[model samples]
Target: MAFLESVFAVIGDLTWGWALIPILVVLGIFITALTGFAQFRFFRRMFRVLWPGNQSGDPNAISAREALLVSVGGRVGGGNIAGVAVAITLGGPGAVFWMWAIALVGMATSLVECSLAQLFKRREPDGMFRGGPARSIIHGLGADYMWLAMLYAVCLIAAFAIGFNAFQGNTVAGAAQDSLGIDRIWTGAVLTVVAGFIVFGGIHRIAKAADIVVPVMAVAYLAMTVVVILLNITAVPEVLSSIVLNAFGLEEAVGGGMGAALAQGLRRGLFSNEAGLGSAPNVAATADVRHPISQGITQSLSVFIDTILICSCTAFVILLGGVYVPGAEAIDGVVLTQQSLAWHLGDWTQYFLTFILLLFAFSSIIYNYYLGENALSVLTESSVARNALRVIVMGIVFLGAVAPDATSVFFFSDPLMGVLALVNLIAIMMLLPTCLRILRDFRQQLAAGVARPVLNPEDFPDFDLDRTAWTGIDPDRR
Candidate 1:
C-alpha cells in the first residue's frame, strides 16, 4: 500500500506540476485570444441564452436550462466548499485572487471545448444526445485518431466514474460522521440506495434531478454567504485587499509565497470549475441549442458561478470569521469552512453545513456517473454492459462512503484526469480553426438581426460535421 501511494504521489506531482498546469494556462490564453475573448464579448449573451423557458423542443434533447443545471451539478461540488477552504489554508487569502484569474481565462477554454462537444454530438437510439472529447476527437479529427479517443474514454472512466465518485462519497460520509454522529456504514448504505436509484434511470433522470437541486442549493448557499458578509461587512474590504496582496508575494502571512498561492489557486480552481479539463464538455454536449456556441456561451457562465461566485463565497466565509490561521496545519477542507461558519453563525451552523455538503457531494456523484457512462458508450454499445457498469458505480459509492483510505483514491484519480486533460487540450488546439469559424459565423448571424444564431454545416465544407444533428436549422430561412 505504501509503495502504491508513493508511486501515485510521484506520478501526480509530475503530471500536474510539470505538465498540466503550464499547458492549461498557455492553452487557455491561446483560446482566449483566438475567440476574441468571446467569454467577455458574449458575457451578456450567456445569461440571455440561460433565460428560463429556452427549450429546443426536442423531447429526447434536454432543455438548455436542464443542460446548464447538469453542468453546474458537475462543476459546483465539494470543490467549491472543501476545495476552496483548503486553498486558503495552504495558499493564504491571496489564493482567491489566483482562482479568479484562472476562471476569467478559463471561460474562453470552456467555450471552445463545449462548443466542439455540441457540434460533434451524436443522437443515441434513445434520442438523447451523447458527445464529449471522444466523440469530438473522432468526428472532428477523423477516424484515424480513434485510438486517442478511446484512450481518453478509458481515462475518464478511471478518473471520474470509479475514482472520483469514491472520493466524493468518502467526503460526504466523513462530513456526516463528523457533524451528525452518524456511522460511516449507515451513511454508505443510505447513499448507495439513493444514488443507485437515480443513476440507474440514466441521463434524463440525472438531468431532471440536477435541474431541481443545483439551483436551490446554489441560491441557498449564496444567500447564506450574503448574510455572513452583511454581518461582517467591515472586514470585506480588508479581506479583498489581503487576497490581492497575498497573490503577489506582498503578504508575509502566505506560506511558501506566491508560488504556493498560484499552484493551489490554479489547481483548486481547475478542479472546481473544470474549465479546460474536458470533463464539463461531456455534459455540455447534452444540451439542446440553436447554435453550438450558444451552449458554449452558457457553459462559460458555469465557470463563473463555480469559482467566482461559489468558491468566493467559501473564501469570504473563512476569511471574515477569522477562523483561518495561516501557516496552521490543523485547519483545512470542509472542516475549515464549517468551523469558520460556526464562529459567525453559531454552533448550529455545523449541522446546516453538513446537510449542504451532502447535497453538494451527492449532486457531484450523479454528474460523475454520467461522465463514466459516456466513456462506456464509446467502448461498448450493449445495454447490459452499461447497466452492469452502473451497478459497479453504485458499489463504488458505497465503498467510498465506508472506506477509511481516501488518499489512495485521490492519488489515483489525479493523474488519470491529468492525462485526460492533456489529450483534450491537444485535440482542442488542433480544432481551433473550426472553433474560430463557428464563433465568427454565430457573430455574423447575430449582427444580421437573427434572434438566436443557428448552425449551418454547409458553411464549412472543408470540415467533417454531422449534418443530421444540425438539420434543426430551418431550410427556408437559410
Candidate 2:
C-alpha cells in the first residue's frame, strides 16, 4: 500500500510540478489583458443575465438560473470545505492569501476557457449541449489534433472516475462513520442507489437535482459557518490579520515563510474551483445557451462564488474556531474540517456536516459520471462502449464510498487529476486567441445595440453585429 502511494506521489509531483503554475499564471494574465479584463467589465451585464425569467424562454438554452445552478453543481464541491482545510493545514494562514490570488486569476481563466467551450459547443442528436476543450481543440486546432483531444478525454475519465469521485465518496463515508458510526458499506450502497437514479436520468435531471440541492446545501453550509464565526466574532479581526500576515510570512508564528504558504493556497484554490483543470468546462458546456460567452460569464461567477465565497467561508470557520494548528502534520483531507466544525458546534454538528458532505459528494458522483460520459463520447463512436463506460463509472461510486480513508482516496485522485490539468491547460493556452476574438466581436455588438445571437457554427461567417439593431428589449438585456 505504501509503495503504491509512493508511486502515485511521484507521478503527482511529475504531473503537477512547480513549472506549470507560472505558465498558467502567465496565460491567465495574458487572457485577462487580451479581453481588456472582460470578466470585470461585463460583471453587471452578467448579473442581469442571471435574473430569474431573464433568457427563460430561449429555446436554445436552459434558463440562466438553471445554467447557473448546474454550473454551481460543478463548482461547489468537496474542495470548498475539505480542500480549504487541507490548504490551511498544509500552508498555514498565509495559504489563504494565495487561495484568493488564485481565484482572482482563476476567474479570468475560467471565463476564457468556458467561453471557448461555448464557442465550439455542439448539439447532440439527443438535443443536449456538450462542449469544452474537446470540442474547442477539434474545432479550433483542426481534426489532426483529435488524438491529443482524445488523450485529454482519457485523462479526464481516469481522473474523475478513480480520483475525484473516489475522493468525494470517501469524504462522505468518512464523515458519516465519524459522526454516526454508520458502516461504510451501508453508506456506500445507499449512495450508489441514489446516485444511479440521477446519473442514468442524464443532464436535465442532473441539472434539476443540482438546482434544487446546490442552493439549499450551500445556504445551509454558509449559515453554519456564519454561526461559528459569529460566536467567535471577537476572533475575526485576529483571524484576518493572521491570514494576511502569514500569507506573506510577515508573521513569526506561521513559521513556513512566504513561499510554502503561497504554494499550499494556490494549489488548493485551483483544486477548489477547478478553474484551469477543465472539469468545470464540461459542466459549463451543457448549458443550453445561444452564445458560448453567456455560459462563460455564468461560469466565471461560479468560480467566485465557489472559491471566494464558499471556500472562504470554510477557511474562516476553521481558523476562527481555533482548530488550525501550525505545527501539526498537514491535515491531509476532510477530517480536519470535520474536527474543527465538531469542536465549535459539538457532536450534533458532525452529523449535520456529514449530511452536507453527503449532498456534496452525491452531487459530485453524478457530475463526475456525466463528465466521464462526455469524455467517452470523444473516444468512441460506439453507443455500446459509451453505455458500458457509464455502467463502469456508476460501479466506481461504491468503490469511492467504501474507501478506507481520506489520504488513500486523495492518493488515487491527485495524480490522474494532475495529468488532466496539465493536458487541459495546454489546450486552453492554444484556444486563447479564438476566445479573445469572440469576446472582441461580442463586445462590439453589445456597444452597437445589435446583439444578435450566434446560434450555429455556420453563422460564424455571417455573425456581423454592426448591421442589426436591437428592436424590443430582451428581458435578459436589463
Candidate 3:
C-alpha cells in the first residue's frame, strides 16, 4: 500500500504540481483575454436567463437554466467544502487567494469549452442533446482528432467517474462516521443503494434530483458560513491580510510557502468548480437552447457559484473560527472544516454540516454517473456497456467508502484528474476560433435588440454541426 501510495504521489506531483498548473493558469488567462473577458460581459445575462421558468416544456429536453443547476449539482460537493479545508490545511490562507484566482480565470475557460460543447453537440435518444470535450474534438476538429476524442472519453471515465466518485464516497462515509458515529461500512452500504436507484433512473431523473438538491445544499451551507462570518466580523481584516501575506510567502502560515499554496489552490479549485477540466461541458451540452452561448453563459455561472461563493465560504469559516492553527500538524479535510464550524456555532452544527456534505457528495455522484454515461455513449451506444459501467461505479463507491486510507485515495485520483485537464484544455484550444465566433455572433444579436439569440447552423460553412438541432429545429424530437 505504501509503495502504491508513493507511486501515485510521484505521478500526482509530476502532473498537478509541475506540469498542469502553469498550463491551466496560462490557458485560462489566454482564453479569458481571447474572449474579451466574456465572463464579465455575460455576467448579468447569466442571472437573467437562469430563472426556472426558462426551462424547456419538453420532458426529454433540459433547458439552459436547468442545465446550470444540474451542473452545479456536480460542481458543488465535497470539493467546495472539504476541498477548501484541505487547501487551507495544506496550502495555508494564501491558498484561498489562489483558489480565487483560478475561479476568476476559469470562468472564461469554462465559457469557451462549454459553448464549444453545445456548438458541436450531437442529438441523443436519451436526452435532447449530448456533447462534451470528446464531442468537440470529434466534430469540431474533424476525423483526424478521433483518437484524441476517444482518449478524452477514456480519461474522463477513469478520472471523474472512477477516481472522483471514490473521493466523494470517501468523504461521505468519513463525514458520517465523524458526525453521526455511523460505521463506515454501513454508511457505504446505504449510500451505494441510494445512489444506485438514481444512477439507473437516467438523465431526466438525475436532472430533477439535482434541481432540488443543489439550491437547498447551497443555502444550508452558506447560511452556516454567514453566521460564522458575522460572529467574526471584526477579524475579517486580519484574516484577509494573512491570506495575502501568506500567499506571497511574506508570512509563514502552513506547509512550504507560496509554491505549496499555489499548487493546492489550482488543483483543489479545479476539483471544486472544474472550470477547464471538460467535466461540466458533458452536462452543459445536454441543454436544449436556441443558442449554444446561452448554455455556455449559464455554465460559467456554475464556476462562480462553486468556487467563488461556496469554496470561499468554506475557507472563511475555517480561517475566521480560530480553529485552524498556522503550521498545524497534518490536517484532515473533512475533520478540519467540521471542527471549525463546531468551534464557531456549536457541536450540533457538526451534524448539520455532515448532512449538507452528504447531500453535496451524493448529488456529485449522480452527476459523475452521467459524465460516465456520456463518455461511454461517445464511445459506444450499447445498453449492456452503460449498465455494466454503472454497476462498476456503485462498486467503486462501496470500496472507496470502506477503504482505510483517505490520503491514498487522493494520491490515486489527483494524477488522473490532471490528465483530464491536460487533454480537455488542448482540445478546447484547438476549437477556440469557433468559440470566439459564436461569442461574437451572440453579442451582435444581443446588441441588435434580439431578446433571445438563435444560432443558424449555416452561419459557419467551415464546420458541420447538427443541422437538426440548430435550424429546422424540433423543440422536442430529434
Candidate 4:
C-alpha cells in the first residue's frame, strides 16, 4: 500500500503538477479565443437559457436549469470552502486573483466541451441522454479509438465515482467532528444511508435534489459572506489590492510568491469549477435543450458561479476576518475556514459551518455518483452491475468517513482526475471544429430572430452524430 501511494503521488505530481494544469490553461485560452470570447459575448444569453419553465418536456431528459444545478452541485463542493482556505493559507491572498483568472478562460473551455457532449450524446434505452468524453471520443473520433473512450470511462469511474466520494466523505466527517462534536463513525453511517437512498434512484433524483439544495446552500453561504464583508467593509479595498499585487509577486507575506500563488490558485480553482477537467460534460450532456450551445453556455455559467462567486465568498470571509496567520503551520483546510468564521461570527458559527459543510459535501457526493454511473453505463448495461457498484460506492463513503487519514485517497484520486482531464482535453481539441460549427449554426438561428435556437443534425451531414437523438426539431416547441 505504501508503494502504491508513492506511485500515485509521483504520477499525480507529474500529471497535475507539470502537464495537465498548463494544458488546461492553454486550452481554456485557445477556446476563449476561438469562440471570440463567447463566455463574455453571450454572458447574458447564458442566464437567458436558465429562464424558468424552459423544460424540454422529454421525460427522460432534465431541464437545462436542472442540469446546471446538477453540475453546480458537483462543482461547488468542500473545495469551495476548505479548499479555498487551503489555497489562501499556502498561496496567500494573491491566489484568489489567479482563481478568477482561470475561471475567465475556463468558462470558454466548459462551453466547448459541454457543447460537444450534447452533439454526440446518445439516448439510452431508459430514455436518458448520456454522453461525455467517452461517447464523444468514440462517436466523434470513430471506433478505431474506442479503447481511448473506454480508458476515459475507467478513469472517470475511479476518480469521480469512488475516489472523490471517499475524499468528500472524509471532509464531511472531519467538519462534523470538529464543529458539531459528532463521531466520525456516526457521520459516515448517516452519510452512507442518505447517499444510498438518492443514488439508488439514479440521475433524476440526483438532479431534483441538486436543483433544490444547490441554490439554497449557495445563497445562504453567500449571504453569510456578505455579512462578514460588510463587517470588514473598511478593509475591502486593501484586501482587493493585496490579491492583485500578490498574484503578480508584489506581496511578501507567508506563502507569498507569484509561483506559489499561481499554482495554488489554478489547482483549487480547477478543482472547484472543473471547467476544463471534463467532469461537467458528463452531466452537461444529460440536459435536454434545443441547441447544444444553450446547454454549453449554461454550464459555462456554472464555472463563474462556482469559483468566481462562491469560492470568492470564502476567500473574503477568511481574509476579512483576519484570522489567517502568515507562515503559520496551524492554519489550513476546513479548520482554517472554521476558525475564521468563528473569529468573526462567534463560537456558534462553527456549528453553522458544520451544517453547511454537510450540505455542500453531500450534494457533491450525489453529483459524483451520477458521473460514475454514466461511466458504468459505458462498460455495462446490467442493472445488477450498476446496483453492485452503488453498494460498493456507499461502502467506500462509509470507510472514508471513518478513516483516520485521507492522504492516500487524495493522492490516488488527484492523478486519476489529471489523467481524465488530459484525455478529455485531447479529445475535445480533436473535435473543436465540430463544436465551432455547432456554435455558428446556433448563433445564426438566434441572429435570425429565433427565440430559442434549434439544432438539426442534417445541417452537419459530415459529422458523426446520433441522428435519432437529434431527429426532432424542438420537442418543447412542438
CA lDDT of each prediction against the hidden true structure: 0.88, 0.75, 0.85, 0.88
Clashes per candidate (backbone, < 3 Å) = 0, 4, 0, 0
| Displacement of the residue 32 alpha carbon in candidate 3, Å | 0.9
User: Predictions ranked by lDDT, top down?
Assistant: 4, 1, 3, 2
Please provide, for model 2 over 239-324, each residue's C-alpha lDDT reduced to its tens digit, 9 standing for 90 to 100: 89998999878884455678879888888887777888888888777765655676788788888888878898899988877566
**What does candidate 3 score in Cα RMSD to the true structure?**
2.8
Whichever of 1 and 3 has more lDDT, that candidate is: 1
C-alpha lDDT of residue 101 in model 4: 96
Colliding pairs, model 1: none
TM-scores, all models, native as reference: 0.96, 0.90, 0.93, 0.96
lDDT of 3 by residue, 80-162 (tens): 87788888988989999999999999999988899999998888655468889998988888899899888878878887788
Sliding window of 10 residues with minimal summed lDDT for model 3: 469-478
- Residue pairs of candidate 2 with colliding backbone atoms: 61-288, 94-246, 94-247, 163-413
